[model samples]
Target: MELRYSPFDFTVHEDPYPFYARLREEAPVYHNEKDGFWALSRHADVLAAFRDDRRFSSRNGIRIEEPFWGPQAEQFFSFVAMDPPKHTRMRGLVNKAFTPRRIAALEPRLLEIARAHLEPLLEGEEFDLIDFAAKYPTDVISELVGVPESDREQVREISFAVMHAPEEGDGQMHEGSTDAMGALIGYYAQLTAERARRPQDDLLSGLLQVSENEDRLTPEEVIGVLVLLIGAGSETTMLLLGNAWHAAWKHPAERERAFAGRIEDWIEETLRYDPVSQSSPRTTTEDVELHGVTIPAGEKVLLLSGAANRDPRAFPDPDRFDLDRDTGGHLAFGNGRHHCLGAPLARLEARLALTELAATVADYEIDEAAAKRVHTSINRGFVSLPTRVTARR
Candidate 1:
């Protein structure tokens, strides 16, 4: 069979590792003439590309879909879509608000939030893990960003609409997604203005007040950051929790280890074994030659981090979901200057949420036949995992 790969292909979404494996061995510099993008699947190649920002530009954003791609990507992706200087400045201002102190302070609140969602489900015999997965991170991020509890559900719905891509489309933003993006922008614009008028002890107000000498974030930039946070911060963690749950359920021994206080290993291994973010998009800044293939300048390229994590060169027995392996350099949160800013929060949320689950639930099972996966351009995970738990005595 001819080796072909497209991020929008549903079949690829079902199991991209095989396709990624083929690309790594047969066509490390695979090009899809139909999708009009090139890909790198080798561990070393993708890692090097991530570190070579000068060569692999982020000016076109990290997604290869329409409307979200191109120069205006900053409107949605904020500093994530920018090259250095611009990216550096924007990220600097935002970092003050995203301090380690702030994140650590949220730990107590995060536990409260997790228990609030998990306790109810524990009272029942069976429930969809997605319900808890979807709600927990939305609330955690909302609480951090100062979104009113009243509006969190609405915000979650809008974020979902924005992240969702129709399984049948050609990777274009549907009208519904367009409207959701508009609505999210409008909501954040109003929130930014309100925070400016009445500063609070929250990230939104911190962003408004953060300044570096004469430089500060514009209201528009603040709004952009919020939208980026709600989308990236919320959705990715939501899927990560779901992926962690599903991974554990599939491997009972590892699941038992996770339940026996190996929470951190479980999270790290899940991240390496089956990351929620499968790929990241970049545009070439100059012609680059690799493996005797010359990729032209300004062409769209995908660094298949999903495949890289599973490379045999990087990990022995890459297919196994063992809780004991050294998952050191996985590109789950990516690499370089563009590494995910929300990584700490994402890990904290997953650790705490899963810890709470492990403490209370002795064992769990996911209805594999009933599990439904989320369809998106760059993300991979379940949207519905029908799960049943056994309470620890």
Candidate 2:
């Protein structure tokens, strides 16, 4: 069989690790002409690419799909799709508002949110873990961003539409997605305007007020940040919870350990073993030669972090989901200046949510046959994880 890799392929979405392994061994610099992207599969290569932002520019955005791929990618991805200077300016302002203190303060609220969602579900005989997984992070992010509770379900729905890809397609954003994106932006724009008018203690108002020597975020930039948070802040964390649950269920012994209070290790191992973010896209600033292949300048490149995380050179016995292993230096949250800003928040949410789950539920079983994976270009995780938990008395 010919070796081919496409982020858009449903088969690849089902399980990309096998293909990633082959790409690492056979073609470390694998190219998919159909998808028009070159991929780096090895850990060293992917890490180097992540750290070498000058060579592998983020200007073209991290997604290969249309509408989200070009110069206007900043509209969707915010500073994530930007090169320095612009990225520096925007990120600096954002840093002032999205502070560590703000995130730390949310810990108590996060626990409350987690228990609020998990406790009721534990009372039921059978429920979808994804229900709690999706709603918990959505509420956390909404609370941080000052979204009204009444509007959050609609926000989550629009975010789902924005992230969802057609099961069968050429891997392009559908009209529904585009429309949803518009609605999301419009919604945030209104929110930004309202915050400008009446400042609140939420992150949105923080972004509006935050300044660096008289340089503050514009209204458009604030809205862009809010929209970016929906995907990066809310959607990714939602998927992370589902992936962690599924990974533990697949490894019963490890699951027992996780249930025995190895929450941090379990979260770390799950991140490396089966990361929610499988791959991230970049564009080459200049021609780069690697492994006897010359990738031309200005081409799409995918840093296959999923494959990199499992590379044996970096992690011994990488396939096994052992909670005891040291999971440091994983590319799960990426590396370099473009590393995920919301990583701390994501980890905190996972820790609090899973810890609460472990406290309330003695055991749980996932209905593997009934579990459904979300169809998306970049993310990989369950959208419907039917589960039955044995509640702790």
The candidate that wins on TM-score is 1
TM-score for each predicted model, relative to the true structure: 0.98, 0.98
For candidate 2, give the lDDT.
Answer: 0.89
Per-residue accuracy of model 1 over 165-242 as CA lDDT, tens digit each: 354548776788878999999998988889999999999999999999999999999998988887788889989999
How well is each residue in 1-393 modelled by candidate 2, as lDDT tens digits?
999888888888889999988999999999888778899999999999999999999997877778789898999899999999999999989999999999999999888888888878888889999888888887898989999889988988887787664544476777888889899999898888998999999999999999888788999999989888888888889899999999998999999999898999999999999998888899998999999999999999999999999999999999999999989968998999899999999999999998888888888888999989987767889889999888889
- Top candidate by lDDT: 1
RMSD of each: 1.0, 1.2
Q: What are the clashing pairs of model 1?
A: none
Model 2, position 117: C-alpha lDDT score: 86
RMSD of 1: 1.0
Candidate 2 runs further than 4 Å off: 165-167
Which consecutive 10 residues in model 1 have the weakest lDDT in total?
164-173
On a 0 to 1 TM-score scale, where does candidate 1 land against the true structure? 0.98
